[model samples]
Target: MAHETDPVGDLTEAQAREELARLADLLDAANIAYHRDDAPKISDAEYDRLKRRNAEIEARFPALKRADSPSDTVGAAPAEGFAKVRHEIRMLSLSNVFEEEELVSFDQSVRRYLGLGADDPLAYTAEPKIDGLSLSLRYEKGALVQAATRGDGAVGENVTANARMIDDVPQRLNGAPEVIEVRGEVYMSHADFADLNARQTARGGKSFANPRNAAAGSLRQLDPEITRARPLRFFAYSWGALSEPLAETQSGAIKRLEALGFQTNPLTALCNGPDEMLAHYRRIEEQRATLGYDIDGVVYKVDDLEYQRRLGFRSTTPRWATAHKFPAELAWTRLEAIDIQVGRTGALSPVARLSPVTVGGVVVSNATLHNEDYIAGRDATGAPIRGGKDIRVGDWVQVYRAGDVIPKVADVDLDKRLEGAEPFDFPKTCPECGSDAIREAGDAVRRCSGGLVCPAQAVEKLKHFVSRAAFDIEGLGAKQVEQFYSDGWIKEPADIFTLAQRYGAGMQQLKNREGWGEKSAQKLFDAIDERRVIALERVIFSLGIRHVGEGVARLLARAYGSWDAFVAAVDAARDQGGEAWDGLIGIDGIGTVVATSLVSSFAQEAERASIDRLVRHLDIQEAERPRTEGSPVAGKTIVFTGTLERMTRAEAKAWAERLGAKVSGSVSARTDLLVAGPGAGSKESKARDLGVEILDEDGWFDLIEGA
Candidate 1:
């Protein structure tokens, strides 16, 4: 780790430690303002100046280097919602150089490290640095086996189930390597994000802060089906551990990846020298904002594999590559006012009302308040703060918008607080229902105890019951549901099914109501009629119980097997406390909070009555039949790859499941069948290595059909 030009090499260990600590503090402050707050206090020029000074100090005092040094990191900590997955190979970050002089210096360093003279030409690859999450996908014999996020470089979250939903990520590869790891960026296209936010706003749901957050949220969803719905795309950029080496050059590796059916960024270009690299970066910078997807900067990597190996890497960053980030997008606006709102789950949220300002091309008027602690700046006694506080009535706040989407407040200038202004007091009761609100210990949210009695909570619950992810009563959109509830046409979820019956004569009158026409009213009625029969999983999720998301709903459906049995168990858990409920908590992955939510939701007399009435009007469909008997693949894990000639991939999967087979996306020792199609690549080879049975399309048809 030692270097000849280290500046801190001459300083004592104590002095080096002091300098390192100062660097950490400065970088941390910058990171909070830039990454978390979205408002950067310093200009890119000034920040780079400070960053270069720190780098010099770190280079001088290598002995005092900290494990989590800002200079060596790529991104912040992996988000909290997803389960952590340790990376098979560390996803080290890249260093950064902003100016052309630094780029030339970087090129010279690469040549010098490789023992190349000035006359010896050097080449590099340049690609747009995607403003998205970094991920690693592992393939054994060409079949995707594991996918993980770039957490702390050393560790990441296991998003294998969700990754399977990305269409670009082939389940199997062609012309497979024995073992390969592909690294890429996961992002949502600009158009898709816009559409998604539009739908969210129309439904009265909170829109995503930006494309990056939307992509992150969608990818981490528990349900594979939900992830599949999001328009997420991937662009393979690098590699990790491999059983056999790739091509001799970085450009060659990318070409090979493209041949293997990976989607590589078409913008990648090979540069002969630092000057060429700078030229390419400048070209990309000129078209940055109009590129459709967000690009924070350009990434440059040495083309020669040998040179990259020779340069090696630091603990968390490669010596062969660097990210040349674009300048920050910033703006200023007036803070008009602050408003507090409640959520479906009863959490009180503060929202900032602002004078319309454009950042990254989108006009923004509001920003999140996070919580009550962020507003008053003190506890009940006006003590000094420890955590975030709510924004006051007239505080000047910095705003930032990225990727032409939602704007967020970056920082508040308390010095500019209006004269004689008083700290805003948070409501102690639910605004809509007057119920006592409780801020649970260890939780940041304050929730209403009124449950179904609260109008806001009730309306939100009814909306969830008929949401697209739930029972999916097509014509029962959020606005329609709200109006129905307010008009007493629907009082509970069960009331939805009996609406036509209860208001048989009034149905004609609905056309006369505000926002309702004859065609719309008829469409609503037809939609309600169409959903009289629902699958078990949908019914479970549509119940609007807390923590019962799509994944949990499916798990419950499978475990209970029938609606009656599921209802019985839920009722039993409510009646016979402790052990009965603890048994639910004992199920791996189902925690106390979820178990309690389920039991509490069903325990209420009103909720039970609604369920009963709904069941009376609706027909609960039987679960799909399991895979056929005496089949060799029955109860065994199967992975399908490539394009199928006999049927669509979805159709093939449905047929397989109907016959009692357990299908998975990746190859493992447990895999019994690999039904590979025409272009079957990696998965087929991985199956060979694992000694799993490999079936061609005809062979699969023969086995399933008993031919």
Candidate 2:
């Protein structure tokens, strides 16, 4: 545990104490931002470095370990929106290893703890450690009962409704125990993330930083409909509370979960020893980008369930498992120029064009500058960054791409900078359309006021309209959209639907075009024809209305049921303070901002004309609805309170939902029924005062006996 050349190792007792306190505050803030807000202020490498330094200091001076030490915490406390769920079995984290030697030492420590020789055989299961939100799904009697997030290890947030919306999460298990809590990571694929960002930009919505943030934000949405619209997926890798033994080994348990209708990682393999584990880690890292999803590292766990039990856990992390994190990759590069790209939303995005340099194998020649504040070496709040060193056009900068698809400037090499280098001056006007680019108060982006007149914004919006999550016309990608736009073949979404009608006279016009022959032109026409009968949600999303991404589109679609109904509602809602306006804002995920944006899209004369013309050429289907027609309690809100003698709260809620009943956490005037248990309190009194139907445990069971 000694490091002769380390700065932390050289710290005095007093210095170590002060450093620990500072590190404690920094780590606490980072955890809250990452876990609660779904926004990380620092990189994973930086967080790991700080944690390692704190641990080293704590080891050097044990007595100096502060009461609020980072080692004692797992995730941050659950945010206030959702009801708290106390985990039956604590969801412990895993220790980390960033080097092969450290992984070897970890194996040695496990062997020493188990009283085994280094030569003795030890099996471990290695799988990709997903860079996403941790969730625990509880099943009761072969039915999915509840889902919770990993909040502060011992407690979590109830996300049962959102979990049910995820396609990967099985609603019911065919053959499983009476009770089981399956743990896994909820992640978004790279393609989905890109598509989501495209839709966000098209609609002038807030875009996520990365796939991890996108997945977290999508899955944690208040409305289940929003979560359902998101392309969120899960990979079951571990388990918590189990009614019976799943399997004798870790790999076997994963297979069992897969067999019982769960998606487990395909790369999860049983390694004979640490060498094999590290080999698997290397293999996984090599195929990282190609894997489609985000994985920060490889997790290795004791294969034998009995061995894991014997090894047990430390304060917050498990002793039997370790995460082999990918090393941070950085490289020095020259800043050739700073280019400003206008997005579909008219946001002026700054791009740093760098001299080609390889960071972590891939050759990176461009990196994101984020916004004006970032280029000026300050954050949104005017906080200093990179020691407040502003970037210049011609300067030596350090670029980092550690496992991220996007490369970014991490630091500036001041010593290597050119003598005459000057600070970058961000543009005040739209570079594409010569429009007034204004930065509104409290907004991070400077946007073009030219609206649809801006060619860049118009072309980008057209591209997004045909994106995978939108209209999804095959052979009509970004390149085709750009080509068609430049050639004046298509200028808007409605123009795409009429391409065949306007230019399909013998197909000669399109066939003779560059990159197009008779077959290719015909294929494009067929693709457009195929997309003419899209679903209502897809049609709504294709419009690229502000703040209306796939999630909002789905919510709006479900609320109105059909395109005509949706249009009618929008027309009726034109008058402020009307019932239609109130109803639009009443949707769970449709806040004031989103509702206002949606209404504005319809209010604008030009936008409404474009939408009407588009609707004329397409067959928009009715929104899909859940099957609740014949259920007795369909649409009735019910509340359960106190200690139930017959079933757990999760079981009761699941049962009620299965019967098509809506379950609420508290008893309000809107509550139709209240199921009171032995220790019912304020809720029961409120229910009585409201004259809502009351049912005891036996009465509730009797009411739903034959349902």
lDDT of 2 at 216: 90
Q: Per-residue CA lDDT of candidate 1, range 494-601, in tens?
A: 788766666656567777887777777777778888888888889989887878897677657755678887787777788546666666666544777788788887
lDDT of 2 by residue, 394-423 (tens): 887878787656898888868767988888
Model 2 — TM-score against the truth? 0.51
Model 1 regions lying over 4 Å from their true place: 1-332, 373-390, 400-407, 419-421, 575-583, 586-588, 625-707
lDDT of each: 0.76, 0.86
> What is the Cα-based lDDT of residue 658 in candidate 1?
60
CA shift of 255, model 2, Å: 0.4
Query: Which residue runs of candidate 2 sit more than 4 Å off their true CA positions?
Result: 1-6, 330-707
- Candidate 1 lDDT (Cα, 0 to 1): 0.76
